[model samples]
Target: MKMNNYYLELFEGRKNIIILPHILPDGDTIGSSIALFYALKKLEKRVYIILNDKLPSNLKFLNANSKIITTEDFEKLSIKPDLIITVDSSDTDRLGDRAYLLDLCSEVLNIDHHSTNTNYGKYNLVNSKAAACGEIIYELLKKLKIYIDKNIATALYVALSTDTGSFKYSNTTPLTLRIAADLIEKGIDFSFINTELYQNKPINKIKLLSDVLNSLELHFDGKLAVIYVTNDMLKKNKIDISDTDGIIEYARDIEGVNIAVLLKEFSDNTIKVSLRSKYDFDVSIIAKKFGGGGHKKAAGCTIYDTIDNAKNILLNTFRENFR
Candidate 1:
């Protein structure tokens, strides 16, 4: 959907703006937020990027000189935002504790590409057809007549590339590539981004991956694959939960597997479940059933049960719905 002219008008006299990314900061959220930050800076708007979690180690390169603050930092500041803009977040729930900002700010502009978005903003520009939120931001910047310099281009490139799985995911479209090509033309280093995003894995991450692979299990005659990552595995390998980002892809890539599940044990009973589908399956359906939501092929939810119980619940759900 095209952005309403009224939404653009929100920025007309707005001076203090806060950009909120999802709870667990990902490349798409971070990249889109930073790109907007640079663009708003050029407009002489005082903008702040506040994140609920720390930036993943691999994505720190994108925030080299950017001033991204934490929730604690925001709490200490006396500034009340004139407008709140959320990027790549489906709903206020995805904002974690920062959701209260929606009530505090009278004006909100929610920009996202998730089909399951709740339209929780005062002015929402939700386009499920867009491959990434970066695409929406790029269009918004163009409409505002903002210049896309190398910094903004690099940020947007990372946003589009990561959400599209380096342009290999099924979501990639002609417009996606066209925007990416434009960003590349701005002199962004695509090769360096590829290296940092895909190739620069730390030793601990490698060890964690090896350990997680040993827990992989196949069900439904290899049509479905499941992997487990417990707190013990993370402690043993000295890796953070963020390191498990791309591990589920390994399970999804299995030859006969149509669906892949990653059950991460955050505690004794809190299991974070990530689901990925390779074909026509819509994993977001299952995620929404469990109070979470995402894209058709990729989604996640937290199950308040033991690892074994969570796996059984997912397996039963799949059998009831998919079998």
Candidate 2:
């Protein structure tokens, strides 16, 4: 899929631009936003990234230039952007408070790979077939004839690698590996990236993982696995919220478990639920029922209830849908 030239034409002579990634930023969102940011900077476009939270600790390497600004910074700015580009977000709500910034812009370009994308932008480039939005951004760069520097390659590689679970997930395709190979050809230290992302777990994270695993519960004839994380656990272990990243994989990896649910208890009343399915069952349906959306095998939603209540409702949904 080529870059929508209509949006490229909109880009011509446009000076003020902002690129946004979804809140609670992930590897895919950060990688896509940074890759696009560097590309636009090469074109001498004045661009900024609207980030709601601090960059994830593991992804700090991708922020070498440190150009990201908080939503507070955006609010203080008097200049409204001429263009806003949202990358990897399925819908505007995922933009958090920054979603309102879209209304102030004259033109918006949405780039995403999620099947549930809402086409909220004036010009949308959505390829659900792509393994990652970084893949789409790579294609768009090709269409625009932009040179991908090493930094750009590294960012895109991070996007593809993480979203596809380092090429282990069902989403991994031949094209994904090819793109990764091309990135390697650009001399990215793939080994180091893999280590930093997967191997370099801090002691706090390890402790949190231990607690999370200890709390794992099985239901529905051992087919549904559930893990819970409470704020109390984080407080005791001195772990940040980000430390819970990928903790759900432990439950999902268990033998005979068809689905895994991670019920994270935050300070607020809401419970964040992360869902993963082994095969056949569409977890996005479950996510959407609770006002969220994601891929078929991997999805998440926030439940405004106690951890126990959220876990019950989610497990029951799994039973109703799959059993």
Candidate 3:
């Protein structure tokens, strides 16, 4: 879909802009923000990429120049932003504490690919069918007649490749592949990126995964698999929370398991739940029920309860809905 000309006009008029990515800082959000930062820089616009969380270790390579700033740093800056653009976020709540930026800036542009996006921005560009927000940004850049250089292509490639699980996930489409091909043509070292993303696992992360796998349990006649990660597990292994990325997939990939869940104890009363499913089941529906949202096969929600209580709540939710 072509980007609306009004958005282009907003960009042309807005000189001081802030780019906000969703909390937890996934590849798609980081990549789309970086790609847009470079594109806007070429236009001579003062662009700032403000993030609520630190970039994951594997994704740090994409921010080698340190263009992305922490919220604390943004607070120190006196420059008033003319516009704020949120990328890969479904709703304002996904911005965490930074959601205040929406109220501060009169001109807000929200770009995202999630089907559950709330269209919260004054100007929203949401395409639920797009494989990733990177695809939409790529199209938007083309529509704006912006030149996509190697840096921009590399960022967009990271967004496309990671969100689609390196094109292994069901969300991968022909256009996704074609865009990847175009990115490769721009001279991105995809091999290095793949190695950094998948092959280069820290020992602490591997140890944490071992502990997490040992907590795995099967339910619903082996159709559901569940795993747990406690703060103790993370502290024992000296692992960061971000190191737990992709660990839930181990449960989801098991044979006969239609649904996989990862219940993470973020705090004494906060359980961060990650849900993945196979076949026709829509996990996003379940996530939305809990005030979170994501794609059909993958989704997440935060339960304000003990780990055991969260598990029971999820099990009951599944029994009530899927049965």
Off by over 4 Å in 3: none
User: What's the number of clashes in each of the models?
Assistant: 0, 0, 0
By TM-score, highest first, what's the ranking?
3, 1, 2
Residue 42, model 3: Cα distance from true site in angstroms: 0.7
Runs in model 2 with CA error above 4 Å?
none
CA RMSD per model (angstroms) = 1.3, 1.5, 1.3
Error of 1 at 244 (Å): 1.8
Task: Write out the backbone clash pairs for model 3.
Answer: none
Model 3, residue 278: distance off in Å is 1.6
Q: Which candidate would rank higher by TM-score, 1 or 2?
A: 1
lDDT of 2 by residue, 96-189 (tens): 7788888887589999998888888888899989999989988888778889889899999999999999899999999999999998998989
Candidate 2: deviation at residue 199, Å? Answer: 1.3
Judge candidate 1 against the unseen true structure and give its global Cα lDDT, from 0 to 1: 0.89
Off by over 4 Å in 1: 64-66
Clashing pairs in 2: none
